[model samples]
Target: MRRFKGFVRGVDGLTRDRGGNFAVLFGAVASVLALGVGFAVNISQLYNARSSLQSVVDAAVTSTARDLTLGVIKEADAKASVQAFLDANSAAGILQANQIVLDKLTINRTAKTVQADVHADIGLYFPLFSVGDMQRVTTSTTALYSDKKIEVAMMLDITGSMAPNWRSKTDKIGDLKAAASQTVEDLLKQNRDPGDPRIRVAIVPYAEAVNTGGLADTVFVEAEGGPKVPPPIDTPLSVSVTTATDKCATERKDKDGYADYSSDGPYTLRQDNKGKTYQAKVNRDYRMKVCPTAALVPLTADMSRLLTAIDHFQAAGVTAGGIAVQWGYYMLSPSWRSAIADACLGAGPTNFDQKKVAKIAILMTDGQFNTAFARSRGASRSQDQGQVSRSNAEAICENMKRDGIEVFTIGFDLNDPSMTTTERDQAKSVLKDCSTDDSSSLKHYYEAANGAELSDAFGAITRNIENLTINR
Candidate 1:
């Protein structure tokens, strides 16, 4: 009985010990605090993995969609393409190279979409109640690609400067040919049907003038005498009069106060007060200047023909860049469709349809525009040939933009040490004003210094032209 009472008293003493009770409480609290901190760390790890996986998937799907749009890869290869891209960039943020897996990929040709589902296995630092030791983070992405028909008119410069410099080994013309040809291949599919094509490109190589080739007689009036007026509006030209003798066409004569830059034409003989017949005359002095050896090719999907024209490009003549821009505008203008059709260009420019068709012009030049025959319609700095040409080009570019044609301009080697400050600024200004001012995804102006940069610029422009849109 005395021993039992002693044991009971010891238990009571232990329960009343404040120091030991406090120690027990601290141990319990420490265990819970450690678990909470570990849980938070696991959550943060999962979030990082999830974000990394999502970004990789988004990029993969977008790249796949672009390839599909560009015909770089077939739809059947899309799964492999996405997986490859994901694998290439798996270590984006706290992600192991092989941790992420491509679970599913869908290429819906009818919907023009590329969809991808990807997941990454993240090892947790601490596993808590109801939470597993490993967390699986899944992400999906979709990209919508446009299959809109594209009409591109490239105005290439073949001025004297583009020729190989005797002092240096720079070959601007050669670089241009290579880059431009590659751009055509990237933008268009091979072996397209002649009758029905989704894309067509026109090459306009200009120097002193745009060599209209077969389009000369159709668009330009014969320079038999001076501008004479008319035999009624619909009267045909007298067969006795010779057809346009020169293939190189200059700016249209500003006769009867007509808009010189306007492509809308009944390019036939016009009527004066009396019913006599005469057509607008081509500028004699301008046409007599050294014309480029390469001619303007109307829009066509014939890859062979397009590439062949690019190959035969020869640099010569003064820089008549404004005239080139004018012709570039005409190539994409539906108003000039009949003439282009007469020249056997495939299904000429389609009517302006914002949703279905993309009309584009890429104007490139290496030097200042120093040739103009038409009087300036805008405010010209000095009414000299350079200022007049700049004004004319700007006016035409504004008209093109107003008509829904997207303009992209490249000033190739404009900053060369040989060019004067005024010349460089003028060249850049013309191109800047001509290009579409987009504050969105891609810029419309590209200043390429060399061959590789030119190729890169063209590649970027083609991607933007494909118009890929992404959704997550």
Candidate 2:
């Protein structure tokens, strides 16, 4: 009986012993903690991989959509384009190019969208405890694109400085023609139907004044009477209204004032009490110092006529940028549609519709605006013409932009060593303010140092216009 009791006590002692129990519990807990840490690390890695994949996919889809919209690639080539983009940049963060794959690509022609799905197999850091060896991160992106009908009015500066002179050996006019022609061709040749072009362009070559061609009678109020006018009587019963013999037109002095931005008008005619019955504002007999003969061409898709007009461009007169900008706005303004129709220039600009149509104005200049007329012959006061031109251009641009017109301005060689500090800043300021404020703030304004840069700027503008947008 004593032996049995001793054995029972020994068993109870063994059961109550705390030795090694702590070590076993700690081992279990350590294993679980290690697993938790590994899982957290892998999750972070997977998140980074997903973000990179999403970025690449978005870029790929946007690029492909732009190509598709530009007709540079077809739907069948879309997958390849997306694949190429992925291959180039798939190994962005915590992922390798070999681990990434383009799973699917969809081109919705009817909806004008391109969508892409991409996936990456991220290696797992925590593969124990029945967890998989890899985790999948997937992302999809969609881009919307279109080639809406576009109307572009180009205000080209053909000032005397543009010609080959002792000051400049380079032919700036030649460069301008090439760059401008390429823009027209690129924008117009995209039309699948020539009979109904999606693009129409107008050329406003301004020197001292805008040559209105046959549009003078329709747009400007001509002053009556000249050296051959009859004496002024009480009624002036037998007065002769001198017809406009010169096609050159300058700023209006109508009831709307000098800086009026509207194109709709039966402008008030100028009057004179003397036997010289006609006032000087619209007097055809008065000639400008340097008038451009390359008359303003209204919006048209006729490449031949446009090219011919560009070919005949002559560098003469001082820069009349404000008047040129006014004419540019008029070409695109709907109020002047009837006048254009009356002149038999094809159906004028379409009404402003942000989605279905786009209106653009590209103004180019090589020097500061130095000329403006306050009366029939010249300025009434001695004022800085550059400031006047800049202010007027800004006002006109403000009105044009309010109407949804996108303005782009180019200052070619404005930074040349020849220009004074004040002159350069003033010239650049006008161009910059006149341009549309883009998201990047650089796309709509260009400062070209040379002809090559000019061409590149134009190309960039064209691409920006055709660029696709990613859906939110």
Candidate 3:
């Protein structure tokens, strides 16, 4: 009996030992599984938060780059703008104020590059499982802003056709004026620089001709008969040869005692030698006077007189777009160098600065060179035709460009010659070929059929000018 009881006690002890071992093994396995699951959850949360933060950073950098390109905001503002963008786009509760950091924002003006370094803290999901509170994510981006200056010119067509609907308030001229005024205002607003004149505008108004009413007389000479000559001398030879008998009689004593000499008709001269033969001849007629040459007025920012002059434009005679373009070129020519210098260094308070940058001319035309002023008998021959020839116009453009003056040509409401069936194709060809060397300088060239489209085209050009930026 004693031996049986001892064996039972031993069996009970063994069962207790097995039960304790099983409990210990199960606890260890369960703890390991919990830890693995916690690790996975924390990693996933961190990855997701990091992804969200990266997205915000990318967006901020992109926005800042665009603003910098447009010259709307400076480097300091760019950094601030980026930070603001990140704050607006970041996921809620993830990026705390302390987590967001702008390490560096360097704008290299000479290199035209904007570099930014961003750092953000990613908070851990399970604090008890992690040693540190957060992880750091760094990112950077560089953007370039072009510093090239843009030169532009605006040439308007103000021919006789422009006044077709003169009786109506919505005439073509009126529409053009409105479009031009709006364009000017927009351009001035968009690209305004008090420090540097990054862009300049010159308006050329042409109809049958450009009225150069203010140019120096020396630069333009009127034709006396066949060739242009200098101003006539006011000497005794230039005085009329007709006799003033009544005035001379009061100052002289005559043998016939007559107060005034009376001739039956106009005075005639007769000569006789030894009664052989005598002949009478009439006096020569006076010479015809020539019209003075037209003058050119310099361009200015003053809109009152310019707009008023445009409003009062009267189109008479034919269209000579080429001559008009040439005239536009002349306005910017150094041939007026003396006048330009005088104007710049003159005594007036508003004298132009000689060191100011050169000028530009925008020449626009809707028609081809069809007609010009007719040359009268014995008059100096003008360019065989009144309108400048295509070749001539091209040469003019080249010359102007050589003189540091840029030219932009536009063909409005004209058909392309390349399109065989379209009318006015020849005119289109002329305009298409009439542009400055740089194609982009010709901002907006459209073939509009109506006034609305024309106005839109003008607006488009103006907007382009406004949006142009010089980062330097």
Worst 10 residues of 2 by lDDT: 224-233
lDDT of 1 at 345: 63
Q: Clash pairs of candidate 3? A: 155-362, 160-315, 212-295, 215-295, 215-296
lDDT of 1 by residue, 236-346 (tens): 557333444467876765545233676654354544545554454333332355867788888888888999999999988888777888889888888777777776665
lDDT of 2 by residue, 1-472 (tens): 9999999999988867955797799999999999889988888888888888898888889888877665567778989998988889877877786667888888886687888877888888778566688777888899986656778999999988788655566888988999988988887776656777777899999988888886776433334332322222244534533345567877754322334555543222234344333322332224355558899899999988899999999888798788888889988888777677878988888887766678889999998887765322233445677767777788789989999888999999888787899888988989999999867434799989889999998888776655412221
Better of 2 and 3 by lDDT: 2
Which residue pairs in candidate 1 have backbone atoms (N, alpha carbon, C) closer than 3 angstroms, thus clashing?
230-276, 231-276
**lDDT tens readout by residue for model 3, 1-472:** 9999999999999998799789999999999998788778778877766666666666677667656654567677877887787666655445665466778878887776667787777766655444676667777777655444443345577655555553544356666767666665554443445444343344556654444443322222222242121112222444412321111000000111111111111112222232222112111111211111222334444445445555555445445555455556544544444544454521111112222343446666666655433322333445454333444455556666666554555665554232244337656656666754534443534566556877787776554443333211
Q: Quantify all predictions' global Cα lDDT against the true fold.
A: 0.78, 0.76, 0.50
Candidate 1: where is the Cα deviation over 4 Å? 1-19, 71-125, 131-140, 189-196, 222-225, 228-240, 257-259, 265-287, 376-382, 467-472
- TM for every model, in the order presented, reads 0.79, 0.72, 0.56
Comparing 1 with 3 on lDDT, the higher-scoring candidate is 1
Cα lDDT of model 2 overall? 0.76
Q: Where is model 2 more than 4 Å wrong at Cα?
A: 1-52, 67-126, 214-216, 219-246, 255-259, 265-289, 375-387, 467-472
Winner by lDDT between candidate 2 and candidate 1 = 1
